[model samples]
Target: MSPRSILFFLTLFVLGITASAQYTEKINSNRPGTSQGAFSVGNNVLQLEGGMGFGKEKHKIFDTKTNVFNFDYTVRYGLLIEQLEIRLNGRFRADGVKQTVGANEEKINRSNFEINTLGAKYLIYDPYKKPKKDTTNYEALKSWKEHYKFRWKTLIPAVSAYVGANFVTSDNPFTFPDDPAFSPIFAVIAQNNWSTDYGGDWAFVTNIIVDKVTTDNPAIGWILTATHTVNDKWAGFIEYQGQKSDFYSDDILRLGGAYLFDQDLQFDANIAFNFKDTPSIFTFSFGASYRFDWHTKDEIIEKPGLEGGVKEGEEQENEEQEGEEGIDGEFDEIEGVENDSLKLEKTPFINTFEDDSFREELEQDLDERRTEERLERERIEQEKIDKKEGKKFKKEEARRLKREAKEAREAEKAAIKAEKEKQKMIEDIDAELDKMEKEQGVDGELDDIDKQLQELERMENELNQEEKEEQKAEEKKAEEKKEIQEEDVDAEYEKYQLQQERAKKEEAKRRKKEEKRRLKEEKKRKKEEEKRKSQEKKEDNENLDIDKELEIIDN
Candidate 1:
C-alpha cells in the first residue's frame, strides 16, 4: 500500500479495565498493546475499538517485498451475564507486493479481512473476601493473597479461561481450496486489582495461550501485563508477549497510556518493540472508545432510585459503620476513665516532686475526683430515665384519681335518688289514708245512723228466721199429705188424663158447633136479603105507579 493509504489510518485502539469501582466492564488496553486482559464487558454491554496498522516487510525467498496497510476492529459482547462473553478482534488489510525478474518488474495486489480471534471466555473463580469483625483494623480483613507481600496479582484474582479460533474469511493467493486457514486457541487468564491512595488503583492481567495453528508444532504464547491509574482520568501500562515461531522465537514489550475524554469515552496509545534482531516488527496504535447502555443508566446514577440499589445498600452499611465508630469512640472514652491501671502506668503521680505523704494525699484527691465524675454521669443518666418513668406514673395516678372521683359522684347521686324515692313512697301511703278518711264521710268515726241501720237489719233477719221456722212446720205437714197422695198418685194421674181427653173432645165439639152456627146464620142472612130485595122491587113498582098518578094529575 502507498504511504498515503498507510499514514491516513494511524488509529490505535484501547479498552479500559473498568469504568469505576462499581460493577462495569474492564478494559485491559494499554495505549497500544496486544495483551488482552482477563475480563469481559459488563452484562448486556457492547464494546467497539478500532485502529490502523502499517507493516513493511522484505522477503528473502523471492526477493519480493510487501507493504501492508490495515485497520483492526475489536468487538466484545458480554453474555450469560458476566460469566461468559463473545469477542471478535480482527483486522482488515490490503497488501501490495513488488517482484523483479531480470530487470522486469511485477506488482501484485492482495486484500482480505482476518479475524484474529473469535471466542468465548468463561469465569471459573473470583475473589472471596472474608468478613471483618473489626473494620477499624484493616489488616484483619482476610483476602486470598494478602499474606504474600509484594506479589500484587496473588492478592485477589478472578480466574477465567477462554477458547477461540483465528480465521481468514476469504479465498486468495492460493490456487487450491484445500488449505489450512483456521487455527484454534485455548487459554487460561487471571486478573488482579488493587487500590492506591493517590493515583486511584492498579490491575495486573496474565494469560497462557495455546495456539494449535501457529505452526505444525502447536505453539504456546504468554502475555503478562500491568496497569496503573495515573489519576481519575488517565492511566498507563506495560505489557510483555512472547512466543516461539517456526523461524524465530520473538518477544514483544509495549508501553502505553490512556486518558478519559469523558466518563463514557476514553483515548489510548502505545508503541511496541521487538526484542529479536532477525525478525524486527514495529507496531504503534492509538484510538478512543465509548460506552453506553440502551436505556438511560443516567437515571439510576443521578437519582439513585431507578436501578442501583447498591448505592443505598452501601450508604446503609456506611451509616452502620459510623454508628459503630461512634460507639467505639464512646467505649474508648469510658475505658480511659475506668481503667485506672492504664493511667497509673502512664503516670503514677501528677506531682513527682512532692513527698510520699503529699503524693498519697494527691492520689486520694484524684481518686475522689474521678469517683465524683463517674457518680455525676450515673446520676444524670438515672435522672433522665426517672423523668420519663415519673411522667408515666403521674399520668397513671391522675387516671386512677379521676376514675375514683367519678365512682364517688355516681354513688352519691344514687344515694340522693334513693332517699327521694323513699320519701315519695311514704307520702303516697299517707295520701291514701287521707283519701280513705274523706270517702268515709266522717273524720274519725262512723255515724250513729249507720249503727242503727245495722241493728235494724239484724232485727229483720231474726223475724225472717221465725217466718222460716213456721214455713218449715207447714212444709212438714204438706210432705205428710204428699206421702198419702203418692199412694193414689197413679189413679189420680189416670183421672186427670181422662179429664184432659174430655176437655179436648169438648173443645173440638165447640169449635165444630161454632163453625156450623156461623154457616146457618150466613144462610139465614142470605134468605132475608133475597126476601127484602123482592119486597123492595114491589115497593119500587108501587112508587112508579104513584109517580105515574102524580104525573097524570100534573097534566
Candidate 2:
C-alpha cells in the first residue's frame, strides 16, 4: 500500500477508536482474585485486566534464595450478555535463583520469563444474572436478586463451568515447568451474592478445579472466596486456595480489594500468602472495559431492550419540544416579515448562545439522586432485619408456649398421681382395720375357751359328766334348732294374720273419718241455709206490719 493510503487507513482506525469510546458501558469484573464470578460484560464489549506480583522464596537445605516475578494480562469479549464469553488470559513468569552453602554462593539462571497459562471461561448456568431479561427501568434496577425472586441461603448457588489450557512458550533449562507443553485445566464454579443487613453486598465464590500441571501428574485444587462490597466503589475479598499434586500439596490465602474509579474502570491490589511460606506473592492491577455499537448511528435507531427504547423516547420528547417552540417563534417572525416567500427558521443557536438546560438539570440532581438511592437501600436493609427478627421472636414464643404446655401436663399428671395415692392409702387402711377386727374376734373366742377350760379344771370329777352333758346338750340343741324352725314358721303365719287385721282396721278407720267429715259438711250447709231463710222472712214480716199499721190509720 502507498504511504498516503496507509495514512488514510490509520486515520480511519483512530476515528473508529474515538467512535467506540463514545459508547459507554459498565462491566462488573471477576478478576484480581482467585475465584471467578458468574457474570459477563454485555455483548460486543472488550475487557482487559492486567496484574503484576513479586515473590521471594528461601530454602533451608541448600540455603538457596529465589525471587519470582509475575505478570498477567487477560482479555475478555462478551458473546452474549451474562451468558457466554470468550477469554484469552495468561501469565508471564520470571524467576531469579540463587544457590549458596553458607559462604559458597552461586547464581544460576538469574532471570527467566515464561508464559504460564492461556484459558477461556464459559458460564454454564446461573441462578441469578442469566437469561438476561430486561427490567422495565434498567437504571432503576439495582441488583439481579429480582431475577431469582427467591433463593435458599444455603442451597442455591449460581453455578458455572469452564475448560482451558496452559502452555509454556519459553524453553529455559533452569526455569520451572521444564516441559514446553500445554496442560488442560477444567473447573466447576459455584457462586452467590447477597446483600447484608447493613446494606453491604456479600459474595461467595468456590471452584473445584482439575488441572494437568505436568505430563504425567494432574493437580486437583479448590478456591474459596468471600467478597464484600463495602460501597459502590470499593470491594474487599478474602480467598483460600489449595492445590494437591502427586508430589506435594500447597495452600494459599489471598486478601485483596478493588477500587472502581467508575463503572467502566477499576484498580486492584492483592497479596497471596502461602501456608508453607510466610508470604508468597503480592500483585497490583489496573483494568478497563468498554462497549460499542456494531453498526453506525445512522443504521441503528435504538438500543436493545428497555434502555434502547428509553433513548428513542427521550429523543422524541426533545424533538416535540423543539417543534412546539419553532412553531411559536416562526409565527411571531411571520407577523413582521417583509419577504412573503421566505420563512423565519428557528434554530437553537441562531438567536443567542445559552447553557445546555438538560446538562444543567443533570448536574443539579446527581447528588440528590444518589442520596435517594442511599436512603432506599438503608430502608431495604432495615426491612430485612425487622423481618428476620420478627421470625426469630415468633419461633422463640412458640417454643416457650410449647414448654409451658408440657409443664402444665406434667403438673396435672402429678396431681392425679397424688389423688390416686390418697385413695389407695384409704383402701389400705380399711383393709387393715378389717384384718384387726377379725383378729380381735379371734382373741375374744380364745378367751371364752380359756374360761371354759378353767371351770372344767375346777371340777375334775365333773369333767367327764360335763362332757356327757355337752354331748346331750349338743343333741338337745339340734332338736331345739328343729323346733325353733317349726316355731319360726308358726310365728311367721301369725305375723301374716296380724298384718291382715292391721290393714283391715286402718281401712275401717279411714272410712269412718271420711263419713264424719261428710256429715259435718252437710250439717254446716243446712244451718247456713236455714239462717239465711229466717233472715229473709223476718225482713218481709217487718215490711207487712208497717203496711197494716198505715191501713188502720186510714180507717
Candidate 3:
C-alpha cells in the first residue's frame, strides 16, 4: 500500500482502538437493540462514555479531501459471573466533513450521523479462582492469578458495526447520492495487560476494521492499527486506512497518551502526522469517557467487645472519693482552734495522754511508730495479694460465662448449617428418587426412600427451629449483659469523679494546716528578734551607769 494508504488504515485503526470498549447496543444506532447478548462478563456493570475530536480528513483528489470533525458516545452493561461474562454494547457518532475539489477548488462541506449498534462477548475461559481465605490480600493474590484470558465473541471478536444514512444539504456543491447511504462496519480488536496492577502500566492493543460505504456500488474499505503502551499512560501507534481502489488511501502514525482517571473516567489525546503527499496534514485529537454500574457489592466484618474492668475501676475511685469527703466533713465538725498554741500544734500531734513521755521518749516512740507502720504496710500488701486472687477468681468466672455463651452461639450456628445441609441432601435425594421412579416403574423401594427422606427432613427442620430459639435466648442474655456493663461503667465513672472531689478536699485540708504552721513559725521568730534587741539595749545602759559611778568615786 502507498504511504497515504497506510496512513489511512492507521487512522481507522486508531479510531477503532480508541472507541468505547462497552459491549452493548447503543440506543442511538439505527439498528437498535439487535445484538442483545452478553458482550462483557465478570462484573455486573454499566458504563456511559463519549468523545469528540478534530482531525484532517482526505478523500481522493478529484473526489475531494476533507477535514473531518466527529463526536461519538456509547453506553454498555454486562453480567460478571465467577468465570464468565456477558455484555451489551451500543454507540453513536456524528461527523462533519470539509472536501476540496480539483485544481485548488473551493472546499465542500457535508455532515453524516449514525447511531445504535449492539454486540456481546463471552469469556470461554478465565484462569482465576474464588478466594479461599477471609483476609485474602488481593494485591498479592492478583500476582498469583493468570494474566491472560480467552473469550468468545458472539458475533465477531472486537468488532463494532453500525448502519446509518448520510444526508448532504441541498446547498452543497459536490454531487451527492439522492438516497441515504448504508454504512456497515466490522472490526477485530485485541488487548492485553503488561504486568502491572495499576492500569497505567504497559498494554498492547490492535484493531482491524472492514467497512462498506453506502454509495458507489457498495465499495469496500478496511483499516488496521497497532498500538503499544510504552508505560501506563503513554502509547505509540501506527495506522493504515484505505478503500480497495487506488482512488482512496491515507497512512498515518500517531503518538499519544491516555489518562485513565479511574475505571469510570478516561481521557486520551494524540498528535498525528498524515502522509497525504500533496499537502502534509497534521492532526490533533482528544477524547474522554465516563462509566457507570448497575449493581455494587461489598463486605463487612463483625467485632468483639472487652470484658468489664473499667467500670469496676471507676466504682472504686468513686468509693475512695466518698470516703475522703466523709473524712473531710468529720474534720470540719471539730471546733476551729485559734490559740498560738493551736497554730503550733497544727501538725497532727502524737496522742499525748497523761502517760506520754519527754522529748527523748517521744523520739523513741516515733521509732516504734515507724516500725508499726512498716508491719502494717506488710500486712496490707498481703491483703492486696489475697484480694488479687479473689479478683482472678471472679475474672475466671466471667471468662467461663463468656465461653459458654460463645459455645452456645457456635452450636446454634452449627445446627443451622447442618439443617441446611440436610435439607439440601433431602432435596437431592428426592430429585434422584423421582428420576429413578420415572425410569423404573413406581415401586415400594422408592416409596420407602421418600418416606424416610421426609421423616429426616422434618426432624432436621424441628432441630433447626429449636436451635434458632436457643440462639434467640442467648442473644437476649448477651444484650442484658451488655446493658449491665454499660450501667457498671456509668457507676464507676461517677465513683471516680467522687474520689477526685474527695482527694481535692483532703489536699486542701493538708495545705491549710501547712499554712497555719508557717504563720505560727513566723510569729515566734518575730517575738524572739524583739526580745534580743531589748536585751542588748539594757546591757549597754548598765555599762554606762557603771562608768559614771567609777568617775564619781575618783573625784
Per-candidate TM-score against the hidden true structure: 0.44, 0.44, 0.33
lDDT of 3: 0.43
- Give the per-residue lDDT of model 3 (tens digit) for 98-136: 444444567445554433344344433211111122232
Q: Estimate the TM-score for candidate 3.
A: 0.33
- Candidate 2: Cα lDDT at 132: 27
* lDDT comparison, 1 vs 2, better candidate: 1
Model 1 pairs in collision: 12-285, 12-286, 12-287, 16-27, 17-26, 17-27, 31-269, 31-270, 32-270
Q: Report the lDDT tens digits of candidate 2 across residue range 15-93.
A: 3222210111235577668566655554556777777778777755656677777777777776634356676776666
Position 520, candidate 2: lDDT: 53
Model 3: lowest-lDDT 10 consecutive positions: 299-308
Candidates, ranked, lDDT: 1, 2, 3
Instruction: State the lDDT of candidate 1 residue by residue for 67-157, as single tens digits.
Output: 7677888777766454577888877778788888889989999887754679998767755222112122223213224322343333556
Best by lDDT: 1
Candidate 2 wrongly placed segments (more than 4 Å):
1-26, 80-82, 110-116, 129-154, 170-180, 196-199, 277-555
Task: Please list the C-alpha lDDT of all candidates, in the order they appear.
Answer: 0.57, 0.56, 0.43
Displacement of the residue 542 alpha carbon in candidate 2, Å:
99
